[model samples]
Target chain A: MKCQDVRIELLAYLNDELSSEDKVTIENHLSTCGFCAKEIVQLQKTERILKSGLESWAEVGEKVNLTEWLQEESRKLSNKEKKKEFTKGFAETKMLKHKWQKVIRFAAVALVLVMLMASYWPQLVKASTQMPWIGPLIKQLVLRDAGLSWAYEHGYMDGSLATVEQDGVKLTVLGVIADPTQTAVIYLVDGIEEDFSVYISKINGDGAASWTSPATKTSVGTIGIAQTYPLPEGEHTLTVILVEEDRDAGRRNERLSLELVTDRENISKLSISYDLDQEVTFDDISVKAKRVVYTPTQIMVEYTVIGGTGVGGAIPQEYASYLLTESGEKLYRVRSYGSHIADGVRELYEVFERPADVSNLKMVIPVQGKHQEINIEFSEPTTIGILDTDIRFAGWVHEGNMIEIEMHYEKYGRVKSITGWSVVDEGGNTEELTIWKGESFGAYENPGDFAWVTTKYELEETDRPVKLIATQVLTIVEGNWEIILPAIN
Target chain B: MTESEFMERLRPLEAYLYRMALAIVGKDDAQDVLQEALLSAFVARKQLRDPQYFRPWIKKIVARQCGKQLRNRGTVFPMGRGEEYVFDSTDKGKRPEDHLIWQVVNQLPEIYSQVVILRYLGDMSQKEIAEALGIPEGTVKSRLHKGIGKLREMLEAEKGGLANEMSGR
Candidate 1:
């Protein structure tokens, strides 16, 4: 067999799809020709890349809990069946009523009346609750809107109002509420004709602020804007800006800004902090719980782990902390954030949904042992580009329609963020891909002098070739800001 | 087959059906399609002539449902970004190359893409692919070979480009 014939049937031969005779012919030809042999090797490599890529893609793809989902669907189906049965029963009852109406017409009429009342009961209750006098009471009870009414009910609102009038428009700061998570300001705007816009110009303190909702046109002459921010607990001033633009004129008709000092005294006193120095020891590591903060919404626990033996060592999964109430109910940690290495100690913070009215709580950390470290080695190193920093691609793993490139860095703890990565085909049309996950330096097992990280991207199959490029890399900055929070009783 | 018998047969193939739906409509809509397909298969169970063909029969329903949804929404195929569909494991991560290959497969013609997904991701045999697609065995083989050839060509081009890039550097 010639090289051309061998190449044509190579994929089929590799896939074992060709007949035994054709396969034997290719094999006989490949034995004598080194070029055909090399071609077969390349073909096998390509097949591996494709198959492995698909396999990994399958692994990463979204998984559905089939049993649970099917059970829920089955329940819904059964409910539909029940509804049908109920309708059938109601029809039979109607037939029976028709037969009885000849003997007892008043009793049949009473039964129909009762059924009508039962059907409309929910609507009737809703109508009663929507009465003019009852609306405010219901709103207060439910804390429906995050506005002055809610703040007033939560005891975070102050009666003192600040008013600013400019350009025939009057803006009144109805109340202010401040807490650890957010500081909300409710303001009323008067003299706005039809359409208007409101913005929180600035919160003169640490953290960020934005308008929680658009200025709602509450009534004929009044509109309200509620702005909230995670403001640092201290005395600070807030600026509210109102702008009215005329589209036909293509210009602003009126603009006004008002500044007011936040009523710090009236803010809700909801959170309490305790200094803890508790320690728990396991086989491989020791965990110290340094501080615990309890708030109505969440409980924050700060801890440090030390003496885990290995490169890229992590706290064992079994050591995950949970709260145990006095009644022996366990509450799992809902979220954990801010894991950083400081002074050679792994510092971690976890947040859990606070159990109500639990004065004393036991934080349990069942330490199992150190997790086994898996070392990933890159056999092929591909050098692609030159930037100010030394970042190289070590190797990549393929799974269906996606590839994860192992990124190696020369310097540890320098690269902050990887952004703007995309695969550009030969046609110059770029198909943008995202880095789904990234690990900081020292978080992984680094065998060489440098650290390694892996990032995954979505790929498209094109007839033309493609190259990967990153638009930006943010470097770590060296500084920290501390904000003081007031103690609440 | 009765509805219960159909459901009993389909229960084990739910994962396969899910991946197939995901390939066609994407992760967000895959569940809806799977649900609709199962409900449809249950409702039309009596129409199934042979119980042995339940796998392909259900798969056909899922594919048609997925296509209908895509048309109704006027959405192009492969709508989600790479990050939207991720492996649940923290230990295993995807590479850029894997993503690239996935995209290439997705960008293939609908017929080719369906055959590739069914053969590989759905873990179906050639016969099953043919049955599910209502195509002859020879057509399935032809499409599979052509689809794979196109993929190999693209991959080879990409490798050549990378080599050039390395030399240029």
Candidate 2:
């Protein structure tokens, strides 16, 4: 038995639960392995030494009589009850003596409580905000997220949460929590009554363009526009194009801008230009995370997809990527923008959520570009192959001039989302197919859980016997890379 | 459950409940805590889901009473929290073997120490600990692991800070 296997059964072995054969095998393994032996010793020591601290039921149950004890307690309560009954005889005299004193004491305590609540209302808000370690005794009397709160507990928050007024209604930027797949800007709104969609219009800086989130309302008023990848360093004006939804008046677009500054001094950003030079292959594509960076905000990994295009049947076109933390926490993409350098070669930048426990950090990228041709006719359901998720062609509906090609987008593990797909007719004509966007959010809004999404596409007039080819399939390969991260001091 | 039925159910487990109270608030207040817990348990007997759940359910009330009694004692430790405050604080040298475990108790926070004591000394499972404390099983597991890890670290005496903490006034 291996050390790990032996260690798992060591507890049972100590309790004499394992079979004789398995026990002998574990004993042999323990004799050879010091680690497993020490584990058993530690477990035994903890049980033996700590048992002295407790007086168990075996000792007290026989010595103490349960029936007599209950009657005794009952007798004590009855004595107190008799004393209370006796006191009732002088109730009128006692009440007259203590009425004014009691009222004065009650009023004084109530007044003190009210004053304390009024003064510490902001501190109460800080306590509830999820910065784990900060105790209530920090003494900074501030509402929302104070600078001292983040600085003391979290150690670093580049652009700490701040409130801004848009027109008359106010919205506070809670904090920027990012991941490669979905980088959501978690925020809360105040004063505004109607529902609104918060999307980052533009972040003015180098390599700073944050899809995220088609504005998702997480808690009561907390909304985050999960911007994919990492925002560039330094101060930048974030142009938030807030779209308020009104059932009667349709939708109203309100542009509220806020200045977001990534303070480097406070943030524990270690500029480790360390290249891991590792690669994972999917079909003919060689995808590898070359450069890595860690800041107070997020962990960024720059990877490249090297695969020839139009290879047909072998190469994947599009991919949704994510990185796993040491604790196996899956950080999905909130938003990301890729730059195409050469044919079939693209350089994409993505940021993963910084690990709370960064012991064994690992990144898994399927972001493999693809091309799979499956021929489909007018009236039959077509399915894509080689992909984790089964993208099936449900049916089509006739809408005036154009027909809406309805497809059932079911998210399995591999591919997270589908932006668009191309249908090539036999006569060499291409039809423009897109995930139809309407009043309700498209496949992009909530990318993580694509449980059962009905995606409608406006198919252009195409020739018969058309080939429905998936432009991109986000299928993860068997290859995995373990990136040992430095301590985020 | 009726008052008599509640007393009947607590018959065998009263000693164990008394032990938990004794551990949390010491022997001086354990009897008071036990009486308070029994009174509240009798009053709140309706909150018990089933007859089978009476043990852990009543134990949870006992723990809460222990906490309330401790708070009422008003023994507020300061910033460093150097003073040992929990678990039979009066019985300093009851047994020779008690020193190491008591030192461990002194190091840990009240919550973590309670979980550790229940797990190791009381010989309770993580699920049982959660049931007794009225916490999620995940929280119990985390606290158990954290307590064990902290205890192991302090026992190994690898950290130089441990010497200062041990020897400091």
Candidate 3:
């Protein structure tokens, strides 16, 4: 067999899936060909490594008591089945009676409403005229229940109307609500003959902030966009600019710009602070929960990791930290970010959605007590094409279709930032790749060090040349922002 | 079959099911997945046509249950950041290398990971894996080959990294 043919069947041969003749032919090739022989050896080593690494039942089953657990589980299943059967029968009978009762009640209510409306039409109109908001109030209630209203229902302070009309397209900003965290604007669009995309380009605010364009499009010409920012206490002006890109025209129109000021009184007072200062030692590391700020939306825990490894070294494994309630329910960490606070100490902030009525909350840190570390050597860096002066491919680590390439850069060079990259196939098809920030192996410590980017693509049977394309490589620019949070009491 | 009959049939596969669950979702979620699979198997007992296919059928249910859990958690194939290999430190019988293999298998894409777990950990034949995954035997064979190739690459990469660390790089 040829080398390519032999390589393809190497796994099948090792698996003993090959026919007798094919097996013998591969054996003969292996006996003569050193490269194929080495390939077979590596394949065998991988199988052995995989089989030896898997946790067999015999190794860990003794502690589990599977038979007893199964018995208990079966009992629970039987009881649950019984309860379900009973509930199903009861619900059917109850539903029949409830259905008739609901129908009768709905009919009576409809008849009464018809009679009342016929007699009270003039009175209702007079009342609605006196209370000008009554018509919009009912519409608002209907919209709120349908999940269409966001500003007034969500305690957003109101703003004035701003309208912009251009080229038969009319855009109106109905109202707005602003707070420290987000500024929500409700807008209406009319005379849109074609589909268009709307986005907020700028939010000139006092504090550092960014705008996330609304993903949901408006089919009924009404939409809202919430721009998130750290708005300090007191009034702050948000210069909101809305841009509409018409799909058919292929042109973007700057619709309107409005300065929205936040109402200090309407801002949420639902924030509470707690100074934990609780420290727990796990193995070689000391984890301290310094403080916790609880808002209605999220709970932020600021903690520090002391004494273990330095930055870019062995950090804690991905742990699911959460707030344990008195009822033993866990609200898991939704998102987290960390930075080096001092020598041997790293400050990590974890945020979790605030659980309703959660009292006596205990912050559970992820401490594996003991960790088994498996150290593996990565392949040497392969020299790919260089992008600028010093930025180039350091090497690549891959498994199956997933490949992570390391791009090395000289410290303090002209290339200040590498934002994104892509893998282009021989067909010139480009797939954007993400930076591999895997804990142990892929993370880059310093800007001058190599950055690991990963992409997954199908490997064709025929050899196809591929190139890595780096995008948004910024030079001689500093990308930094500061957010100063007030001290929580 | 009745619930009792299903329970009796599943009893022998409990240990296998537990290990597969642990391998897929890690220790924190393994028990829940196993219980969910068992309950689902019991609930759908009437759908079982052949008693002979009980083992593979139940194993398929368990695999699907793990997939559902992974989906609900919003994680697809390939381990996310900080989700590296974590061994049960309390299991003195487990070596670091064994945990490493479990981690590697868990990190495999769901399609390949399911097949690998079923074949090796479940002691399932290729035909059994094909039946469990509702895929053709040829597809299972190809996935197994590709999965093994990926496994070899990952192992080699690790070996290279270990050598670099040992060499004081």
Candidate 4:
């Protein structure tokens, strides 16, 4: 091979990315040429330099304060009582306070939740509402979305099954609640300390379903699995596989799996038959409530967007669409599946928290707003006005190698969502600008076109002639249409 | 994955993710970007059903988060002189800003810089880099080759006067 050709392939050869033939050829050429051989050594040194340079910068990963993040996330989800405490407690743990706030075994390869039969376990309890050790946990899950924990207190669990011990762990089905719109499962485990990875190894139902089990961070041994859609409503097979992984080897060493027949049924068999044939409009966008079903597990609403088409592509006011209580509390949305059913017909199936105090409930759909992307030339402090919002590029803090750019945006309470942004330097090198919510801004009374935001992004180099692109800045439309949900029962 | 579990997977990669983020975004935003990427990985944890793909999965998430900060017409950070240090782990008498390889790598195009960063700083295999960057392995091979070539040339040009280009590495 020629010196030029061998030189081009040297990196690949060093990186072992070359075929054996190319590798041997490069090796043969390097043996004969000192310049090419010296070049290979230089390339190797270059790799080392780059690695160490980046590593020095990466040590700042220690600066990422997850405690504040946990607290903030908890604060965001504080609307829900149980999860708020769960996340809050996780935020304050001494273990999490360790370096990088990192701990526990890893088993990212979770198949899905498993199954259990009535006759599997010796202590399987059926047709009983005896709140098990973690029934109250599922109670919170049910109370928030399915209906309210009141149902568990008043009635019985339809399929409370358990499984025999396998892989040094015992799993008991604490409570199972299934409505047509949503399904939830709360299970109590006897073994498994430390947040070892638990996966739903196999879910064998006629219909497709997935579950999100956060490993009951606050309360160990109790896991609450809930989703917007239910599995096939009959006897179905499923398996919960618990994997004990050896991180060093990066593979699962011991696996415990128990398959059981999950008799999927709506334990309460009661859904609030609420139907509203009403239209609400804000500006040019109109939202009509087509079909509203209140299952114990979730609130399923089929909303038809009249004039709010192509505003954020099928999801008009998704961030603003939620079930609002008379007391002005926003319910958490579980999932929003928006599909184009047919020509001129769009379907948005939204699942949200259904509070027990089902009084004066309204489906609030705000008007879809028109937004614009703007580029700001900022080297020093600058302020730009977009509609009613004032975005101030505050200042820069040069710490070590990072240039911290502080930006604050103040608008109304409604338009507080940070759209998107990116930065570029004088060298034409694009930066992945991560504008974090540096500090919390108190409430604002003014109606906003954008939002009240204080954000910061760090750059290694301040190549001048910087441009900050604030994509999707202002919401031009204002006004929320609220449709009072009336009960048919 | 629980927060702790996510953190566990992230523990080993904290420095790696930070490097990748810093290489792409810079310092001031590395913390925020790393946190944002971690949160994103946690949110999308369910999608990662294979344990083996965890590293590549998280790296891809961080890269994608950086991808969001992809506006091409701006400059940020005055390059905190204090933060500029040699890749030396030790705080010896060596000058930090002489990180020539680091300086040259950044000047490389995004295509090469990303491949190189993911390979060395990320400690990722060529295949892993391919998976993380969503490129073919063969493409990864070519990009790494070209990236190193530019880096080496840039190093030689800058260090023509200096005898030892890499004192630390």
Candidate 5:
């Protein structure tokens, strides 16, 4: 090896890393070459010195006890485990406490239910006594042609009756009915087959109709008679009379009169058993066209079918129709279905009943004629579906851009789309790229001012002072179109 | 082999491992390097092909650990102003003949100091040093030769050594 090569390996030689052959060669050269030998000596001396120094330092280092430190750490871990056990126990105790509370609350609720049942005890007992077989029976009495009805209930006794004459008219009394003093009064009046004006006067006390009859009018039946009357509670002697007109003499005379003996104590037992649960009434159905306007393309017809459940529970289904003609000739005629069994559309062809679930429909009649006549009839009630209108959007302009808008862009409608579509900051800076129709449509440079252009805006640029607003101009084309934009606050 | 077994085997090589760590890092970071090298050897114990060469293997681990530590730490003091003259056996209590030599060593470029440490502190052969640092042997020689010569010149002015003849002496 050359001297240079030997010097390069000298440190390794001192450290005994060189191969035996190379070491032998280096040692042989060292024997002859003081130059390389001294270099090796100096390098060794440096190592000896550094080794001694480091050895001392290592000796002085504090000895660390790895096992003791690990033991301390393990102790801390066990303490944490103990604390976790205590916390688990506490949580379990709290859960048990909550369970007991729920049980107590349930018991309190049961007790309240028991108390409520006890509070309504008297009502239960009374209801049981009033059930069909237990309480005193109410007797229904039907009087015919006398233009009256009389009934009694709850231990009513026999009543007295008498006849009387006044002004050449004679009236017969049926009797005075009595009640058990608990519910109501029962009056028994004689049945007069013909219509007569009857007046009753209480000679002893106040409960009486003390007046004279105007005339004796004959009746076909007793359907018009009213059973409800105002009578004071007391004992009374009533004189009732039937009056008639003496036509030849032109005089009014009494045909018959009768005395009814009854007391309030006995009459109070009477109970009027009315089957009021059954409601009876009638409905009047009428049809007429209210207003009619005829146009070439459309005939605006407003017709009202008047019908209501009057004095009746419900109105029957009614239908009516109107006919249109040009110069008295047939044009278009439509009517509602006479009576609807199904829920059909409320068109002019279908008819509906009064007191209906859905009532009153306004129809637009398309009249092929200038002059039209309406015909109407009544049928069954009907239900009509309600209708609502929806709007759509077309396009708009903001600033220098053309903004296409739908109902979604309402607030921007009045504003110029050229100004509103392309928003620019006060500094007129927009980081966004202006996309004119898409690239598929061939992108065009915004000549800044054009009939159709698109510009983009950056939201941050407009945040500074001199706040810029987007002025939108919108063009609403066609019908049922609107812009849905926020009102400029 | 387990990490503990690897470290146990390296117990006999503590001096050489520390020296290699010192050669790569400085005094301030040598301990961290030694510990880290031991850990790396433990994790890669299965890959240790030659168990008898464990000392050199540990030395290599120390060198790599030092380098990674330096890179991750970033910015050794600014360099290239002058050469640092270091004496290995100098007592910590005994100040240097020239106190500025340490400042100059810090000022030397990392490239020069790196080779200087490997040569002087590690006592490594140029070829071995080059292999560990992944540089050319010639690069190691050049860096060491120039660094030592510059250090000699810097120290000659304060000490009695001849600037040119110190390596020869």
Candidate 6:
């Protein structure tokens, strides 16, 4: 046989499994072939060595305990049985604990329900007054048992009707007044004659005003007005005034007058309007109104409405107009609500005074719903203080919050100061500052025309000859301050 | 079987069973298989019908147990890899023949090692070896033949390494 053929059967040959004839033939070939004979000898020697080596390795496993594990498994099953019996005994205790837990949870939920009803009691009462029908249903379905508690808290109920005089007309409002924390809407009503004027204002103080005015032939009826004012913690006084006058039928007429007083607290006045002459006046009315107040906190402005000839009626053609001047510079036009004499006689008449400067504006409001022009003058400056005074720069003077420099200035030499400053890229990082109006230096109040003293500016800049500024450091009571560097400018 | 019965059956054949497990699972896991297989067999003794065939049955059980452990452990064969061959070169004074033979055997593949171990350690017949490993008798014969051939080749390579070393020195 060839060496390859013999090699393939060498294991069988070694195990003595080869047929006798084949074995004899292989032995004869091995004796003749030196390579095959040597190969066979080497293979036998290697196998013998490997076998002995592996046997020794296997002897190491002789000590392994295989049977002991079976007994342990059996013992575990019995232990599990024992645990079952023990667990059964604790079931009652667990149930008792669960019951107490449920009771505590129910108590907590009930308390939360009670607290929520108590908190919203005032709002619920107010809502009930307005929507009397749904109030009971809402409380029943929602508050459930807590409804009685809410009712007990708001047992007393009272309401009143008040008037606020605007220009010369009296506007009346009827409702339960709201406090500083609550808000309420008051509807206007004509109280005296048809087409009379009404004035509404948020009350600032408590006072009384006489409700007497002579009615003119061209004047309309009067309406109730309500004003909202702040009350610190107690009773306060509020005053109301009345005014009666005739329409300015393309000519100046006797002016209407009203007086109001408040001795108690601060009140915000919200509404003011005059009764429009419907018969002899125009129908179409349009008003162009804008928000003029531009402080970061709030924006306020006053606008006037100008109107045209009344629609086909004995109400002579009367044109209505209003003017809003800032720093003596007028800005924005006033007009009625619609355009046409047949529409209605209603003017966009509201005044606003924000901390910012406003000038060179005039708008047309139609008294008779039709065409009208709002006159505006833009040349006059409107800021009251120096344009650069109220500005504040932080990193402009120091490296971090450890040091801050507040610069304040006022307008000078007949120039209106448009004061505004922003923290722009402090140390290459943009920062924002919230402007404040406190008793701090350069604080403005009742910002007004060029002749007036206070105003807000779009940015801090100067063109005035006599600019003035006041500055102070804001120190935190518990924080440390370091002098990084003095402000450069 | 009861705990006492299990111990009685295990004590006599423990050595053989351990060796078989070592052959299959390597030294680290051989003992683990022994304990696990014994516990399982003890719990399920009623299923073992032939008492006289205990040794063969236990061997089969140990093999199956080792396979299961490997499978459970996500045992990948690490393709084309086998047990490392450790040659004892410390005995420099021994006849070079002994060292060369040792090196050759060490170089054998794991499958060849199993065959070598069964032949020498267990002293089982060819048919018994085939039955324990669940392979055909012919397959076992072929494995033995190939294993022997590889050993001879490794021995020749070892001689070459020694000669080169001596010449370099």
Candidate 4 on A205-271: residue-level lDDT in tens?
Answer: 3322333333333323445553324444576565554455343343453345555555544442566
User: For candidate 6, lDDT tens digit of each residue in A1-489?
Assistant: 665567667656787867899999888888897656765775676657766655444444323333443444456545765666533365422221110000012254554553344233123223334323322322322121121223223431122333344343334332333322211223222233312322222234423211111111111221122223223333444433222222232221222322332222212222121222212222222233323322221222222223433312111111122233435432221111221223333222222222243333332222332222222111222222221233222112222221123432222211122222233332343232222111122332322311222222111222212122222221111111110111111
User: How far does residue A462 in candidate 2 sit from its true spot (Å)?
Assistant: 27
- lDDT of every model, 2 decimals: 0.52, 0.48, 0.51, 0.53, 0.35, 0.37
TM-score of chain A of each: 0.37, 0.37, 0.39, 0.44, 0.19, 0.18
DockQ of candidate 5 (2 decimals):
0.01
lDDT (10s digit) by residue, model 3, range B52-123: 899878877887776555544532221112222211122332444565566566567877887777666655
lDDT of 1 by residue, A64-165 (tens): 344444444455455764566543244422221110001112354555553333233113222122222222422332242323344456656443455667
Better of 2 and 3 by lDDT: 3
Best by lDDT: 4
**Can you write out model 3's per-residue Cα lDDT over A1-489, one digit (the tens) per residue?**
666567667766777777899999999999998656766776677667666556453246423334444455456445754665543245322211110000112254554453334233112222223323222432332242112243355644353455555565655544555533344555545555333433333444433223322222222243444344333456656555555544234455556554545453454465565676567664457777776665556666777777653211122222235567668775555445554657666766666556665566666664422222322222454443223435555666544334555555443222233434555676877665433222113344554466443322333332444565555453332111111122334
For model 2 the local lDDT of residue A427 reads: 76
Instruction: Calculate model 2's interface RMSD in Å.
Output: 24.6
Task: Calculate each model's fnat, 2 decimals.
Answer: 0.15, 0.10, 0.13, 0.16, 0.01, 0.20
Error of 4 at A56 (Å): 35
Off by over 4 Å in 2: A1-152, A158-167, A172-188, A205-228, A247-252, A268-273, A276-283, A294-300, A308-371, A374-489, B1-169
Model 4 complex DockQ against the native = 0.08
lDDT of candidate 5 over A1-489, digit per residue (tens)? 555567666756776767999889999998997656765665565445444433343333222222222233234344755666533245422221110000012254554553343234222222112222111211322222111122322234332223343342333332343322111222212233222334443344443323221111111111111111223356655554454433234344556644555565543333221111111111223333333222111222323233321101111111012232223222222112122212321111211111111112223121110111211111222211111111122223232222222222211211112223233445765332122221111121222211222222222222242222223322211111111111111
lDDT of 4 at A208: 25
Evaluate residue A5 in candidate 5 and report its C-alpha lDDT on the 0 to 100 scale: 63
Off by over 4 Å in 1: A1-489, B12-23, B43-61, B71-119, B123-169
CA displacement after TM-score superposition, residue A128 of candidate 5 (Å): 79
For model 1, the docking class works out as incorrect
